[model samples]
Target chain A: MLVQFYNVSKVYPKGKALDDISLKIDRGEFVFLMGPSGAGKSTIIKMMFREEEPTRGQIFIAERSLVRMKRSDVPRVRRGMGIVFQDFKLLERKTVYENVAFAMEVVSAPHREIKARVPEVLRMVGLEDKENSFPGELSGGEQQRVGIARALANQPLLLIADEPTGNLDIDTSLEILDLLIDINRKGTTIIMATHDRELVKAARKRVILLDKGKVAADYAPGEYLVC
Target chain B: MLKNIWYFCREAVKSMARNHLLSLATISTVAICILILGMAVLATLNASHLITRLESDLEIMSYLDKDLTADQASEVKQALEAIPGVESVRFVSREEALQYLQDSFGEDRYNLEETMGKNPLPDGYEIKALDPHQVPVIAQQVEQVAGIERVNYGKEMVNNLFLATKWVRVLSMAFIVLLSLGAIFLIATTIRLAIFSRRKEIYLMKLIGSTDWFVRWPFFIEGILLGTAGSLIAILLLAVGYETLIGSIQSVPFVPVLSNRALLIEVYAGLVMVGALLGVLGTYISLNRFLDV
Candidate 1:
């Protein structure tokens, strides 16, 4: 398994965010976490990135339990994964090229590698002409595309995107989905969380529906019930 | 490591430039506080020097009655020499006293002789005391001698000088500590504002797997630069002001001041180090609070 949550649970002071959740994702799989706003899909994604720890149970990424890892080791684990959010958190003052290059720089990537890889990622995201443009100058969808490019800058084996299309129009959403699909076809495992039933239907991927902090249902590709 | 340092320096310089007004405010506040602290240090050092000189020179002067015969004056001197803590007593004749005054007046002796034909200076015994703390007691004993006119021991003046020196020491220490705290708080707030302005960048950096130190290096450099800059300005100002004061003080002839080159260098180095230290402290405080991720 590439990622595993063995009976993981997370409880905030307010309530239980994820209760008794167990699941497994294999390598190169494209999985959808379909749920409403309070279904704890984001929490599950956060646990995978080690942003939040399971209150009770073990979470393993590539067979190493995240709960037992030291704080200093969290970054090493995150380097093998890429994360995207609904807000498309880009540094507004930085150019698109800088936004992607910054991700590599944080990991102390070699100057030659950064210089060579940033342009390639920009081209992959179809933002080659806009590399020099600041995020404020781009459309919402283009900004999210830059977000994806930045996430992929490290060329991780796994990608976790939380509502990647939540802030986009339907046409832009499909484009972003197509881009994700293409990246998945190139062999990166993807776990995307969203509430859009129609989008999930259109993608025809394996779906995990969460309700009230539990996995309500699981469906194979092209067989999900619209919830 | 060298590349990271270059990047940190570049980023620090850019951030400082971006918030030029706040940076200027922080720097000026630090400079002014350090300048006051330097002045206090100089004052405390000079005052202690003056006190040491005064304490070492403690003496009791007992004037002799003009009508006393030579034998009576000799008897009075012998009695004074017998007093506890009296090291020695030297008798000055009327003529010798006048001559001593003339010597002390230097080039103005001729003018003093022209102004007054008769010798008006008093003949007295200069008594050196073994202990400065006992000068007042020995003076009281000498005043009781039969042929002595009056006693002058500078007791009140010495007591006041000691009191003033004590206060100066206390006040200078308090000022240094208070000013350092104020500088730290101001620098910390300014750095905090800078971090807040770039919070998005920091958050993104954290998400991309940068270690806490990697994210903090640029801000730490920014703080160090501000601290050093502020202290350097204060040191330059103090040097100019102190050198001018020294020039003017030379005309006053006898006011003790700290003019040793080594001591001045020590003060300068101390101020610069303090500035840099406070900068690091302030940066540490702000970063710890905002960079928990």
Candidate 2:
């Protein structure tokens, strides 16, 4: 298992956000956290990245216990995973090439490695031709591709994307899904949280449905749609 | 680390340029604060210097017995010099004392000599203490010496000067400390506003696995740059104003102001260091709120 949650719970001032949730994701699996708003899908994703600590219970990512991890060690763990956002957060002033290279720069990668890898990652996202274009000039789909490319620059073991296609049209959403599926095929575990029921059904991946901060269903590929 | 610093500097410059108006405001505020602080420091320095000059000039005048022989008077001088706190003792003969009075009379010296047929001035030994605070004690010791008639050292005036300067030093020190705190708070608030403007950028940096330090380095550099620039302006202004004031007062007598080039350089260096320190502190306080993620 690449990720494990042992009876984890998260409590806020108002109420419990995640109540005694437990699940496991193996390496190279494409898992969809399908739920409506306030389903704790985002909360679980946040815990996996150590953005929020579990109020109770333990979480282990890559066999390292996140509950016991030091605050200073968060960056090192985060570098091992990529994160994509719905709004496609990219520095508007930077070109497509610089945007992707920023991830490596933040880690202080060697100049030679940054020079060689940035173009490679941009090409992987099929944005090699738009390497010099600014985010403001790019279309919405192209911008998200840049976001994915930047995330992949570190060559993470897992990719956690929250609502990656929440703002896209149906056709563009499917295009992004195909790209995600292609990346997963190349041996990267992906856990995406989204409310787009049709998109999840189309991906044909393992689905973990959450409702009211608890796991509602755990179904294998092609099985979730049947239920 | 060197590479990271370089990147941080570049980003800091970029951010500064992006918010040129805000940057200018912060720099000017720093400059004004430092300028006021520098003036206060210079004032206190000058006040203390003047007091020290006056204290050094303070001396006890020990009158010799009118009938004492030259040998006995010389013995009193030797005894005064032997005192632990005595720097030196100069024996002034009655003739020299009379001549000093004559010189003071200027054109009327002949009239003063004609009015008093014989020189009745008593000879005195001028005693200078090593420490100004020991002047009274040294005067008392001088009076106890044989052949010494009386000792006078302007006791009340010296005590008043010391008391006044003590208050001046205390008040200035308190003022400087309060001003420093005010400056730090101002810089912190300004930097906080600047950081607040780019909160989204900081959030994204945190999301992308940048360490808190990594995200903070740029803002730190920006703050330091602002502080340095502000202090430089203040130093420039202070140097010019001080130099001009010194020029205007050059012909004036008895007013001791700081004019040592080395000392002025040291003060400027101190201001720069203080400015940079404030910058770092302000950046740290401002960045603390945003880096929790």
**TM-scores, each model vs. reference:** 0.81, 0.95
lDDT of 1 by residue, B153-183 (tens): 7878978876777887888788878878988
lDDT of each residue in B128-215, candidate 2, tens digit only: 8899999988888888999999888998998998899899899999999999999998999999999998887788778778899899
Local accuracy of candidate 2 as per-residue lDDT tens digits, A1-227: 99999999999999999999999999999999988899998899999888899999999989899997888998888989999999998988889999888888988888789999999988888889998999999888899999999889999999999999988998999899999999999999999999998888898999999999999999999887876
* Reference-based lDDT, each prediction: 0.88, 0.91
What residue runs in model 1 are displaced by over 4 Å at the alpha carbon?
A225-227, B56-167
Q: lDDT winner among the candidates?
A: 2
lDDT of 1 at A147: 93
Inter-residue clash pairs, candidate 1: none
What is the C-alpha DockQ of each candidate?
A: 0.56, 0.67
Lowest lDDT sum, 10 consecutive residues, model 2 chain B, at: B105-114
